[model samples]
Target: MANKTAPDSPPGSAGGTPTRRRSERSRRAILDASLALVGEVGYDKLTIEGIASRAGVGKQTIYRWWPSKAAVLLDAFTADVDEYSAQGLPDTGDLAADLKLVLRATADEFNDPAFQAPYRALAVAGANDAELSRAFVDRLLEPGIRVYVDRLRAAQEAGEVAADVDTRVAAEMLLSPFSQRWLMRTGELTYDYVDTLVDLVLRGLRPGS
Candidate 1:
C-alpha cells in the first residue's frame, strides 16, 4: 500500500512540543490514517497498531502520545476539527443566506463516509457509556454547533429573527433535521434538503413576517 501523506495538508498541526515539528507531523499522519482506516474498516476493527503502521510511525510513538486506540482516535478527531471552522457560516448580513450556508456545511460533514464511521460508532458507543456520551457532547458536538447558536442570536439581535426566539431551541430546529436524517437514514442529505431546512427554520423564526 502507498505510504504517502495526503497532499495539501500543512506540515502537521498544532498541539505538541514546540521544538519538534516532526512530532506534530507524526501525530497528524496517525490521525489521518485513523480516520481513513476507520472509514474503510469499522471502528470495531480499528487498532492502534494498525494506525501506527499506516501512519509510518512507531507503535511506541502512538503509545507515547495516547493511552489507547480510542484515545488516538479522539486526538485525531480533535486535531482535525479545526479544519471545519472554515466552514462556519459567514455573516453576509443576509440571514437566510447565512443560515442556508451553515446548514449545508453541516449536512456536508454528515454525508462524509470517512466521518460517518467514527461518528456512528461513537453514537452507538454513547448509549451505554455516559462518560463517552458526555465527552462526545462536550468535545465533539458543542463547539461547532454553538456557531449556529451565535448566528441565531445575531439574527434575533438584528430583528431578522423574532425577539422571542430561543436561540438554543432555534439552533436545534436548524440542526436536528440533518441529525435526524443522517442518524436514522430517514432521508438523503443534499443541498436541496438543506435549503428546505433553511426555509422551514426561517418560517418558524420569523414572527408574521
Candidate 2:
C-alpha cells in the first residue's frame, strides 16, 4: 500500500516534488477525485481537500496540475483522446443512418447514471462559472461537436446531404435535440426517439410537403 497522504498549502500553493511515477499517480488521483466529488456534491460544496481525500492524494498535488477544480475535471475528460474515437459514432456513409447512430450513442452516454451524474453536475457548475463553462465546452463538448461537423461536411461532398444545406447548422440540428433532452431531463433518451429525430430532420416533418 502506498502512503497517499499529502500536506496541502492552500488552494493556490505550489505542490511537492513528486517523482515521475508518483506524479502520474497523483495526476490520476486528482482527476478521479475531482470528477467523483463533483458528481456526488454538484460542485457547490466540492472542496479541494475533499478531492484530495477521495483521491488518496494531497490537495497540493491537484493545485500543481490545475488552477481550479473545473480545470482538473476538464483534463480528466480529455486525458484519453482515443476514447472519443472508440466510443463516438462510427460513420457508415448513409447520412440518415449515421446521424441516428450518433444520436443513439449520445443517448447511451447521457442516460448512464455513471456518466450522467458527473456530466450533469459539471454542466450545472459550468453554468455558474464562466471559466468552468469555457473549459467544459473546449475540452469535453466542442471536440465531440466538431466530429459531427466533419462527418456532415463529408456527407455534403459525397452528395448524401442536400447541396445547399448548412453543414454546421445541420450538424447542430441533429445533435441539439438529444442534448436538449438530456440537459432538461424532459424525456427519456431512446433509440426510437433518435431515429425519429433523424428522419424528421432529413425528410421534413410536414405531412405531405
Candidate 3:
C-alpha cells in the first residue's frame, strides 16, 4: 500500500492541486521580493540571489519560472501596471480637467524614483530584446494607451471632442510627449509641463475651439 502524502509536504507531494497552489505562492513571492529589492538597491544592483533570499525560495525555483532577472522584474511590474490601467482615465465630464488630472498622476509616477527604478531597468531590457519588448507593449503600454483611447471616445460622445478628430492619434499626442521627455531626458517633466500639453491638445481637439 502506498503512503498518503501530507497536504503541505512539498509542491509536488500530492501531484495536483497542492503543487499548483505552491507554484502560485512561489511565483508571487518571487515577484514581490524582486520588486522590494529593486526599491531597496535599485535594478542595477539587484540579483537573483537577493530575490531568492528575500522570497525564501531556492534560486532554482526562480530560474525555473523566469529565465532572467529582467523577466522577473517585468512580471513584478505587471501588477502595478494593471492597477493603473484598470483605474483608467478620469471621467468628470470635463475633458481638459480630466486630462489634466491624468497627466498630473502620470508626472507623479515618472517623478517617483521607486517606480522609475524598475521601469528604467525594464525599458532597457525591452529595448535589447525583441520578444520582451513585444511582451511589454502588449501587457503594459498598449493597455494603458487603450485606456486613454477609451477616455477620448467618451469625450467625443459627450461633444467635448470634435467628431473628426482621430482619437488614436489624439491619445498619442496626449501621452507621447511625456514618454519622450522621460525616456530621452529631453526636458524636465512637471505637472506644469503636462498641464501645458493637455491644454494644447484640448484646444486642438475640442469642438469649435
Candidate 4:
C-alpha cells in the first residue's frame, strides 16, 4: 500500500501546527527583544544582530519578517501602544473633563523618563526616513487619533460637542498642540497646559458657541 501523508505537513510531523507555534514564539521574542534593546541601547545603536542575539534567533529569522531594525522597532512599538489603547479613550459624559483626563495622562506618558529615549529615537529617525514616517503615522499615530475621534463623536451624540464639528479635525486640534509641545520642546508639557488646550478647544466646539 502507498504511504499516506499531507503535502503541506512538515517532515516527521502530523501537521504544521508545531511550526506555526514556534514561529509565533519567535515573533514574540523578537518583538520583546527589540523593545528591551531600544530601551537599553537607544535606537541609534540597535541592530538586527543585537535583536537576533537577544531573541535567541538567527538574524535571517528577523530579516524574513522585517526588513530592518527600524521596522522591527516600529512593530514592537505598535504592539505596545495597541495594548494600552485597546480600551479606547474615556467617555465620562462630560467632554471637557474627559478630554482633560486623557490629555493629562498622555502628557504624563510623554514626560516619562523611561519612555523618552525610545520614543524620541523613533520620532527623530522618522523625521529623516520617509517610509518609516509614513508607517509610524499610519500604523501607530492614526489609530490612536481615531480613538480620540470616536470619543468626540460620542460627545457630539450627547450634545456636548456641536453636531457640525468635524470630529477628525477637532481631534487633531485637541491633540496637535500637546504633541508639538512635547516633540518640539517649545513649551512645557504640564497638566495645566493640557487643561488649557482642552478648554480652548472645547470653547470653540461647544454647541451654540
Candidate 5:
C-alpha cells in the first residue's frame, strides 16, 4: 500500500518539514481534482485513476490518503462546505431568529452553482449506493443537521421550546421542507419561505402557557 506521508523526515529538523509540506499539498490537490472531476464527469464516471491523473500524483498517493472514490468525494464536499460555513451555527439567544439565519445561509449555499453541482450529484449517487450513502450522511448531512439539534436543545433549556418535544423530529421540520423544495425545484427558496418555516416551528413547539 502507498503511504500518505513522505518517508519519515528527521524527527526534529527543518530538513524534513518540506517533505511533510509536499505531502499536504499532494493531498489537497487530490481533493480538488476529485471535486473538479465530479462536476465535469458526474459521480458514476469518476475514478481513482482519473483523480490521480488530474491531480498529477500517483494512484498510490490517493489510495494512501483515501480508501475509495466515495471517500474522496465526501471529503471534497465537506472541505468546500467548511470554506462557506466556517463560523458554525449561529446562537443569538433567539431560536426563531437563529434558525432563520442558519436556514437562509443554507439556502444561499444550495443556490450557489459551485456548491449545488457537487451536492446534487452526491445526493443522487447516494440514493443507489449504500456505502456512499452512509459516508455522505455521517460525514456531511448529520453534522449539518446537528446544528439544529444543538440549537433546539438550547431553546428547550432556555424555556423557549417545550421540554417534551422531540428535537430530532423538530429539527426535521426546519430542514425537510427546504430540502424538498430545493431537490424538486418546486418553489423558490426565498428568505420568506424559510422565515415562515421557523415561525411555524416555533409557534407549534413553543412551551405552553
Candidate 6:
C-alpha cells in the first residue's frame, strides 16, 4: 500500500486539540494543587509560587487564570462544591425530611477534618479580601443557597410550603444558623442540631404556624 498522510483534525471533533487537553490538565493540576496546599500550609502561608511549584506549572500560568492565591483557592473550593451541588437538594415530596437530610449532610461535611482546614481557610480569606469575598459568595455560596431555594419552591408548588413564604429568606434561615455554628465554632454541628433547624424552619413556613 502507498504511504499516505492523514488529514488534520478539528479542535474538538474527536479528542480535542493537544493545546486544549494540555490546558485542561494544567487547570486541574492548579486547582488540585491549590486545595492540597491550602490544607497543608493554610491559606495565609499559601502563595501563587507554591501552587505553581506544586502543580508543576509556571507562576505565569496560574496568573493567566487567577489573580491571586485567594482567587485560586476560591476556584478550587468552588470546583469541589460543584460536584455535590450538581445533584442539588433532594425532593422526596416530604420537605422536612429532605431538609433534614441535606442539612445533616452539610453538618457532616462541616465536621469532617479534611474539609475543615481548607474550608476555614477559605472562609477567613474571604472575610479579608473584598474581591475574593464577592467571588466566593457569587460562585460558591449563592449557588449552594439556590439549591435550597429551588427545593423550597418545589415544596411551595406542591402545597407543602405556604404560598406566602419567601423561599429565598426561608432558605437562608435554614442555612445561616448551621453556617454560623460551623464557622464560629459556637456549637457542635450535629445531625440533631440540623434536624432541629429543619423542624423549626419548616414550622414557620407551614401554612398555619
User: Model 3 over residues 1-209: C-alpha lDDT tens digits?
Assistant: 12133232223212357656667688778888998787777667889999999999888777766788877887787777777787877899988888888788878989898777777777876778898789889988888789999999999999989999999999899888889999988998898898889898889987886
Reference-based lDDT, each prediction: 0.75, 0.72, 0.81, 0.82, 0.80, 0.81
RMSD of each: 5.7, 6.2, 5.4, 5.9, 4.3, 6.0
Q: Could you give candidate 2's per-residue lDDT for residues 138-209 as a string of tens digits?
A: 776777787877877777687676677776786688778778888988887889888888888777422233
lDDT of 4 by residue, 8-124 (tens): 221221235775667667778888898788877877789999999999988877877787898788888887667657888777798888889888888888999777777888887
Better of 1 and 4 by lDDT: 4
Model 6 stretches with alpha carbons more than 4 Å out: 1-19, 83-86
Per-residue lDDT of model 6, residues 156-209, tens digit only: 999998999999999999888889888888999988888888898899998877
The residue pairs in collision within model 6 are none
lDDT of 5 by residue, 1-209 (tens): 34534643212112447766677677778888988888778889999999999999998777766778988888777874555445666778888888888789888988888777877788889998998889888877787777778879988998999999999999898898899999899998999999988898888898882
Q: Show model 4 residue runs off by greater than 4 Å.
A: 1-26, 39-42, 84-86
Leading candidate by lDDT: 4
Q: What TM-score, over all chains together, does every model reach?
A: 0.83, 0.79, 0.79, 0.81, 0.84, 0.84
Off-target runs (Cα >4 Å) in candidate 1 are 1-19, 83-88, 207-209
Off by over 4 Å in 2: 1-22, 80-89, 204-209
Model 5 CA lDDT for position 115: 70
Model 3 root mean square deviation, Cα atoms? 5.4
